[model samples]
Target: MTASTSTVARTATPRGSILKQRVRWGLDHALPRTVMSYAARKGDLPGRLIVESGNVETADLVDLFDAARADGPLHRGRFSFTTASQVTVKEILTSPDFRTGIVRAGGPLAGLREWADIDILGPLSAPSLLVTEPPDHTRYRKLVTRVFTVRAVEQLRGRTEQIANDLLDKLDPSSPVDLVENYCARLPLTVITEILGVEASDQERVLTFGTAAAPSLDLGLSWHTFVGVEAALQDFDAWLTDHMDHLRAHPGDNLMSKLVAATEDGVGLNDAELKATAGLVLAAGFETTVNLLGNAIALFDKHPDQLARLRAEPGLWSNAVDEVLRIDPPVLLTGRMAVRDTTVAGMRVPEGAIVSTLLAGANRDPEVFTDPNAFDVARPNAAEHMSFSAGRHYCLGASLARMEGEVGLRVLYDRFPGLALQPGAERRPTRILRGYDKLPARLS
Candidate 1:
C-alpha cells in the first residue's frame, strides 16, 4: 500500500472510539448549554446569544447584537465576552494575542482535547485550518491556498459562468421553482467538486455530508444534532480516504491531485493532515457559497431598487456581491480565545476568555458604514465586510464565493429578469452557517 493509504488506515475509528465520541458530544452539548443557560437567566447577553444561536427568528440575534454594540463591543459574562463592534472584532481577529481551536486555554474543558480526540475530523479540530494557528496553519495554507487565489478563481470564472448558464437553461421561467435546490446549491457544488477532482456522481453525497455536517462549526449542539453530525462526518472522512487513495494513484490536474504531491521544503503533509485539509476545502468551498447565492437572491428579491441598479449598470455586479455579503452574510459569527490577557475596545479581557464576535452585527456597525442597516449594492465600502472573516483566519474561498455569487445571480436574473421570491422561505437551522435552505421563486 502507498504511504497515503497506510497513513489513512491507521486513523480509522475503532468501534470503541465511536462510543467515546458519543460521550464527548453529549458532554459538549450538556455542559455549555447548562452554564450558558444559567447565566442567561441572570440577563447575561453572552450566554443568551449562545443559547439562542440556533433560533429560527434571527431577529432575536439582531436585537441581542444591537444590545452588544450598545454595550460597547465587549460584554464580560459569566464565562465569556461578546462583541459586535467592528473595531474590536477586527482587533481580535488580527491580533496574535488571540487564537482559535481550544475550548479555553485554562478553562474546565481543556483536558477534553487530549482525552476525546478519538478520530473525529471536525473543522474545529487541530488539523483543519479553521482552528489551527500559525506554523501549522501557515504550512497547510501555503500548500493549499494557491488554487483559490483571485487569479486562480478568475480562471474558473468563465467556467463558472458556463455552469451558471447551463443550470439556467434547465429552469423554466414560466413557473415557480425552489432556487436554493435547483440553482444555488448545484452551481457551487459542480464548480468546487470539479476543482477538487471529484466525479460528478459523488456530488450529491458531498452535499448530503455537507448538509449534515455543517453544524460542526456551531457551538452547543444538542445530542441528536451532535450525533447526526458526527455520523455524517465519519462517512465523509471515509469517502475522503478512498478519494485520496484514488488521487494518489491516478493524479489529475485538479487541486486534490496537486495536494497529493504537495510539500514544503522536503516534508509533505501526512495522511491525516492531507485528509483534514482536503475535506475542509471541499466541504467549505461549496457549502458557504450555496448560502451566498441563496442569500443574494433573497436579498435581491427584497430590494428591487438595488437589483434594478445592477440591471441598468452591470459594473455594480461585483460590488453588488460584496453588498449582499455585507447585508446578509452567510456566516453569522466566530469565536476566539485570548492567548494572554488583552485589552479590546477599551475593555479588559483576561487570558483564556472566549470572545464571540458577531460578524453580521459588525457588518452593520454604524461606526463603519452610513445607514449600515440599509442594503445598497453600490455602497462604496461594501467590500470591507467581515463576511469572509478577518486576519489570518480569513476565508480561503472568498474569491471563489464572490465570483460564483456574481455569475450565478446575474445569470439567473439575466435568464429571467422578472424572477419573484415567493413566501415561506426557510432559513437553515444551523447557527454559524446561515442561509436559506429553501427559497421558492417565480421565474416569470
Candidate 2:
C-alpha cells in the first residue's frame, strides 16, 4: 500500500484507469452539469458560465456579469445562489454563517462528495486548509502563516530577487521563446521547491505533476482530461509519500521537514493531513504565481502605456501587480456553502444553500471600480479586488505571490525594455483557474 517505494514517473496509465475516470466524471461532473445546465436554461449566470463551451473571451464574461448585475446582487439558481455585486461577494466571503467547502452537506449532490473519494489528496478535500473550518483551519494556518506573512515575505524578498534574476539571465531571448517555459514558470518553481526542501532534479517532476493535476480545480471536465489528471494525482501522491518519508528520516530546514516534525498541542499532522497540507502547499506555491507572471507579461505587452507608467515610477510595481490581479485574476470564482440559515444583502440564504461568487465579475463591478473594464495600473484603489478571496480562506501565499509578480515583471522589463510579444497566446483550459498556458515572446 505504500507507494513510498515508487518513482515519480510511472509507466503508461492502464486502459481500465480510463474507465475508472469515466465513471468519476459521470458521478462527479456530468451529474453537476445536468443541474447546472438546467439552471443555465432558467437564467443562472454561474451555471451558464461553467457549462458553455468554446473559447472564453473577455467580452463574453462582461455580458454574463452585466446580466447577473441586472438580476440584482443575490438571486437563487438551481445549482446555487449567484451574485455579481462586489459588496455581496465581500459579505458572502466574510460571513460567519458560511463555511469553507465545495459540496454542501445534505444538499442535492452531497452524495457526490462520498463518491468523489480518491486515494490521493485533493486541495478541495478534507484535512486541507481549503475545506476545513475554524479550529482545524486555524491550527493549520497557524503552523504555516508565519512563513508567508508580509514580514516573512519581506525577509524572502532578497532571495526572490536573486531567483528572478537567475531565471531571466538564462533566457536566450534572441529568437522566439515561450516565456512560460523559459522564465515565468521557473522562477516560482525554484522558490517553492527550495522552501519545500526539494532538489533541482525533482522540480520539473513536481511541475509536471502540478500541471497535469491543475484541472482538478475545475468541475465538469471531459472524461479524457479527468483521467489524465487522476493519473498525475496518483503519481504525485506516491511521490509525496516517499518524499515525506525521506524528509522525516533526514529532515531539512524547509517547510515540509518542519511540518513533519512540528506538533500542535503535542499532536502532529496525521499522514493524510501531512500529505494534503504539503501537496496543497507545493502545488499552490507555484501554480497560480505562474499564471500571475504569464498573465502580467501578456497584459504588459498589450498595455505598454502601463509599463511606461511603471518605468516612470518603479515604486508602482507592487500596486501594478494588484492591478493585474484585479483585471485578469489568476482565479476566476469560488463558492461558499451556508452552515446555517442566514440572510445576506436582505436575501434569506437557507442552510445548505451554496453561494457562488464570481470573483472576476466582482472585480469588474462598475460600482466598485471606475472604468471597470479598462486596465489601469494606477487606479488608486486597485488593491481592493477580491481575487485572493476574502476572510479566512484568503490565499496563504498572497504576499509571496505579490512579491513574486512584482519582482518577476519588474526584473523582466528592466532587463529587456525592448521585449516584444509574439502573437498566439493561449489561456489555460480550467474554468475555475485563469491564465496563459503559452506566451510566445522575444527579448532584445
Candidate 3:
C-alpha cells in the first residue's frame, strides 16, 4: 500500500466498444429516465409536489438518483398540468429547502411542533434535519463541531485500521468472503461505537438500531417500523441519560462525557436535543461509511485498472474516495422545504414548497465537470464533490469518514495485495443506500 506500489500514474486506456456498451446499458436500464419522466410530468412551478405515487412500479430514491446522475445536473423544463399530477403522485420524497428561504419562513421544525407523527425521536423522523435551516442549523452544528474535528478523527485512524485488519484476519483466504458484511459494514459500526463511547458489549445492539434507522425516510412511518424505532429510541435515550449522569459524576475521554460537561457549563443540550443529536450521529456515522466502502469496492471491481492503479499509488486512496463519493454517494437526495416563493436554477418555487437538493445530479453536472461519467481520481477538483453535502447542513463527520476510508483502503491493500472480488455475491437490495449486502472477495 505504499506510494510506490500505486499504478495511478500509468495511462492504461479502456476499450471503446466496452465503454459504449456499458453506457448503452446504463441509459437503457437506468433509473434517471423514470425520475426525469416524473419531474417533467408532475412537478409544478412555484409549488412543492409531495411525491407519493407509483411506489410499486417506480424506482426508489436510490434508483432515481442513479437516473438523475445520468440526466446530468440541473434539468430545466416546463411541467404540463396533466403530467404534474400523475408524476407527482409517484414520488415519495420530502423537500428540504435548497437554501435558507424555507427556514426563514418558520421551517420544518415549526411544523414538527404541531404534529406527533413528526417523531423527532423516531427513525422516520431522520428527515428532521433536512427540514431545519439557517440560524438553528448553525447553532446546533457549532455546538457539536468539536466532536468531529480532524484531530479527533485522526485519533481513530488506528482503531479503524485495526478493525479492517481484524476483519481481514477472520476471512478464510481459500473461500469467498463477503466483504460488505465482514469488512465494510463491520468497520463503520466499530468506529461509530468507539466515538459514541458505547460499551463493546452493546455495540451490535446499537448498530442494529442504527441500520434500521437508515431507511426510515423511504419506508415512511408505518405503525410497525414506527413502534420499532420508538422502542430503540427509548433504549438509546435511557442509555445516554445514564451515560451522561456517569460523565457528570466522573468525566471521561469519550464524546458523551464532553457533551455532558458542556451541559454543565450552561451550553448543555436538553434531553430532547441530546437524544436527537446522538441519534443523528449514530445513524449517519456508520450507515454512510458502510455505503462508501461498499460502493468503492464495487467501482474497483468494475474498473480493475483503477483498482490496480490505487494499489500501486496508495496516496491516490484519498482522491479515489472522493471520486467514489461523486459517482455513488451513500445518501442520494437530501430534502429541503421552501419558505417563500423563490427561484432555484430559474424555476420559481413557492413558500412552504419542498425542494429536493439532488446531490447526485449536482455532482455529475457536465457544466461543472469534464467527462463527468468517467472516474478520474486525479481530477483537479475532485474534492469539490457534494457527497458530504454543503452549506450549513454539511456533514459534521466528513473528516472522520474520510479518515476511515483512507485507512481502511490502505490496510486492505497492504494486507492482501491480490484481493479480488468473489465470482458471485448478492448486491444489497437497496435503492437509497448504494451498497452491497454481501461483497465476496478473496485474498490470494
Candidate 4:
C-alpha cells in the first residue's frame, strides 16, 4: 500500500474499530496487578493511546525502509508529535555530530508537559543516558559503564543461558504454547530482575510496572495509557528508590549494588539520577531482549532453511542471532538531533531538528549489505547492523542482550527440534518496536 493510503486508512479507523482494537490490545499487552485488578473490577480498559502508531508493518518494513533510503540517506518526515528526519544509512548513525541531547527545557517535548502523562517523552521527565547529550550524557554514561561494562555483562552469560533453559523446560510439549508470554517474555524479565537483585516476591510487581510504562514509549498514547503510565512511573520510581536505598546499606554482587558503589569523577549518582538510571536499566534490559527472542523465533519459523542451517552448524548460533536482529530488530527506530547545522549522509540538517534514525532501515540498506532482504543466518556482515545502534549512545546492555538472544534461540531450537508455528500467532500493533505478542507454537 502507498504511504498516503496507509495514512488515510489509519486516520480513518472508526471508533468502534478502535474500541475493539483497544480491547484486544488490553488482552495482549501486559498490565500491572493494580491496573489489571482495577480494570477487572471496574470494567475500565486501559485508556486508548491516542498517538498515531507508525504505519510500517513487519512484512512492509523493508520496503518502507527502502523507500526512505531512496528518498536519500536522510529523509525528512513527521512522526506523530515530532518533526522526524530519519537517517537510513550507517554513516549517519556513526556520526558524532548527531546526538540524543536534543530535547531541552522549553523544547517541543517540554511544551507538552501538561500532557506529560501521555506525552511520555523521557527527556521531559529527567536526564537519563538515553536522552541527555554530552557532558551530562558523558557523566551519566561513564557512571553507567562502571556498572554495565563488557566484562560485567559477559559474566551474566551462564545465568542468562540457565534462565533461557529453565523457561523453555517448563513449556508443555503436547500443546501449542504462546512462545512470547511463556518463553520469550519470561526469560529476559527473569534475568534482568535477577541481575538487579529484585526480591523474588516483588519481581512480578516490577514486571507489571514495566508493562504499564511501556506504552509511553510508543509515541502515541491514549488517556488510558497516560493514566496507567503516570501511576506506573510514580510507583516504579518509588519501588526503585526503595530498592536502591536497601542496596546502599546492604551491598551485594547484584548490579544495583554496583551502581550504588559506582562513582564518576569522584562523584556518586545523586538521588534523582540514581532512580532514573536504575529505572532505565530495568525497563530497557528486558523490553528489547524479549522482542529479540520472539522476533527470532517468528523469523526462523518463516525460513525453515535458515533454521535448518543454524541447527546443523551449532557454532553458527551467534551469527544466527545477529541475522535475526538484522532481519527484525526489536527496537526499530531511535532519534538523534543535529547538534548544529550538520550534514548527515550529505543532507543538511538544521540545528535542533530531530532525525529519527531508522535502524531497521539502515540494517537493510542494499548499498551496505548484499541481498539485504534475504534472511541468511550465515551472513558474515550481519553483526554490522544498527540494531543495537552505534556511536556514543549505543545500548549499554548490548553485550548482555546479545548473549541472551544467542543462548535463548539455541536452547529453544535444541529443546524442540521439531518446533513449528501453530496457527493464530499475532504481531503487536507497533512500528518502533516490532515483535510477536503471541507466537503460538507446537513443540513436538
The residue-by-residue lDDT of candidate 4 on 1-444, one tens digit each, is 100100000111122344444542332233323343443354221111112224334556454555555545555543211111233344555677666533343433343332222222251134566765677778888888888888987888888888878787788899888998899989888888887878779978988887766655654445576456656776776677688788788887788778877886679888777777777788788778988999898888889999888878889989889988887888876766665787665566777665666677677777778998889999989998888887777889888888989988888888899999988888776556678778888999
As for TM-score, the candidate ahead, 1 or 3, is 1
RMSD of 1: 4.5
Candidate 1: stretches off by over 4 Å: 1-22, 55-60, 103-126
Write candidate 1's Cα lDDT for 105-193 as tens digits. 33454455436643332342225777667877888788777545688788898999999999888988787899999999999999989
lDDT of 2 at 157: 80
Alpha-carbon RMSD, candidate 2: 4.7
Model 3: CA > 4 A from native? 1-131, 219-235, 263-266
Scored by CA lDDT, what does every candidate get?
0.78, 0.77, 0.56, 0.67
Best by lDDT: 1
lDDT of 3: 0.56
lDDT of 1: 0.78
The lowest-lDDT stretch of 10 consecutive residues in candidate 3 is 2-11
RMSD of each: 4.5, 4.7, 13.7, 9.8
Residue 308 alpha-carbon offset, candidate 3, angstroms: 1.3
What TM-score would you give candidate 4 relative to the actual structure? 0.81
Expressed as tens digits, the lDDT of each residue in 368-423 for candidate 2 is 99999998888899999989999888888888899889888888899999998889
- Residue ranges of candidate 4 with Cα displaced over 4 Å: 1-56, 78-91, 94-96, 101-125
Evaluate residue 62 in candidate 2 and report its C-alpha lDDT on the 0 to 100 scale: 79
